[model samples]
Target: MTASERMKMAAGEWYTCIDDELEALRVTARDAVFEHNSLPPRQRGNIAPALRTLLGAMGEGARIEAPFHCAYGFNLFLGEGVFLNAGCTILDTAPVRIGKGTLLGPNVQIYCAEHHREATGRLAGLEIAKAVTIGDNAWIGGSAVILAGVSIGEGAIVGAGAVVTRDVPANTTVIGNPARAVTPR
Candidate 1:
């Protein structure tokens, strides 16, 4: 049997995001996000339940602050002690795995999806995705953008406002638009 669009998407193959099944899933996720973002901080008791329903896997002590946005929350996995600050956005068209103790500063964006380079394909709504992985104890600074297929290694630090297009080595610090490793002090 041929693979479904969702299956193809998860496999990082080209797929159409406008599929009815996928659109339905996005709707469900959007509803959960809306509810989660609407609640006041005083109503903290209600937040966890919504996140549990939305995310694929949410580990113990994982905390995502309000105003989080994602295409499909079900594709997101958060490990123990992960903290996502406010205004975080993840285009989880494919899996986005955040390892234990990883921290994402405010306005951080993780994108697992990409459109076709060709105009014909782009106009046809053809898209592809790649899973993004962040290793344990890593710190992603505020406003950093992690692109598709990038794996951030353990203990790595991505400086503020950096755009990470490549894999980050363990225990290193990277900075700038096309992030480059900083000389260790």
Candidate 2:
């Protein structure tokens, strides 16, 4: 199978693919520490380099935290000032795009692949990947799981520990497990 096919196959069984992409991504990400991380500590602490490396993995102007994990580095894209706190993980089998100035708190997970539990296509390993986009200036609180095809609009605030399954409009706050709009203010 080709690389893309391998990624499709690795969706449910995520161990090997995530491991495979990590080394190459780390290599590309290592030197970026000098470019983005080698800044004064007083400004934003050590997160700058991490962001720089992640951006490097995705290409230019894609700032991301170093310690973050993804299924495929190339499938994930980051924007300016995208702060991903410690323990951020992205399953980017499809695509995960985080807009500029978005703040992702600790333990935030973004996933793009959805699997079928029924034993229908077990041999072929077919699964669908839906893109997830977080618009500019959105704040995702700690431990939130953003599922596939969900878009969080600009300036939206997602409550801590919320499991987002759908779209959230701009300038709104969402809470609870399924993540519904709590207020429009």
Candidate 3:
């Protein structure tokens, strides 16, 4: 028997995002996210419980500010001491894993979904996905966008408003669009 679209997606293979099962997962995530975002910020204590139900795996001390958005919360994994500021968005068509002690600034966007280069394929609702991994102790600045299949190494820093299209080396600082590494003086 052929595997379902959801199964292929979970395996990090190319699959159509418009599958009914995937749609149902998105709907479930949307409902959870809506409920999470509705909670008053003053009630800080309530956030974790909601996230625990939404996310696939959340380690101790993981905190995401309200108004977070994701295509499917079940595909996101947060490690211990991870902190995500307000207005974060994750398009987790595939798995998105954040390591311990990572910090994401406000308005950061992480995408694990990609479309085919050919317009015809995209028009047919065909899509591909790659897992995104942010290593331990990394810091992603505000408004940074992490594209599909990129891995930010341990202790790496991504400057504000940068667009990362490639893997970031460990302990390096990357800035600007396409995210080139900063030369040490």
Best by TM-score: 1
- What is the C-alpha local distance difference test score of candidate 3? 0.89
Minimal lDDT window, size 10, model 2:
10-19
lDDT of 1 by residue, 32-100 (tens): 888778888767542456666789998888888898888999999999999999999999998999999
Index of the highest-lDDT prediction: 1
Per-model tally of clashing residue pairs: 0, 4, 0
Model 1: lDDT of residue 169: 93
- Compose the digit string of candidate 3's lDDT tens values, residues 20-82: 998998898888888778877776543545556879898888888887899998889999999
Task: Order the candidate numbers by TM-score, best to worst.
Answer: 1, 3, 2
Tens digit of per-residue lDDT, candidate 2, span 1-185: 44554554435342223334544654554454444434555553544644434542343343444455665545667777777776788776666788888889988999887765556543334456678899998999999999988999999999999999999998889998999888554
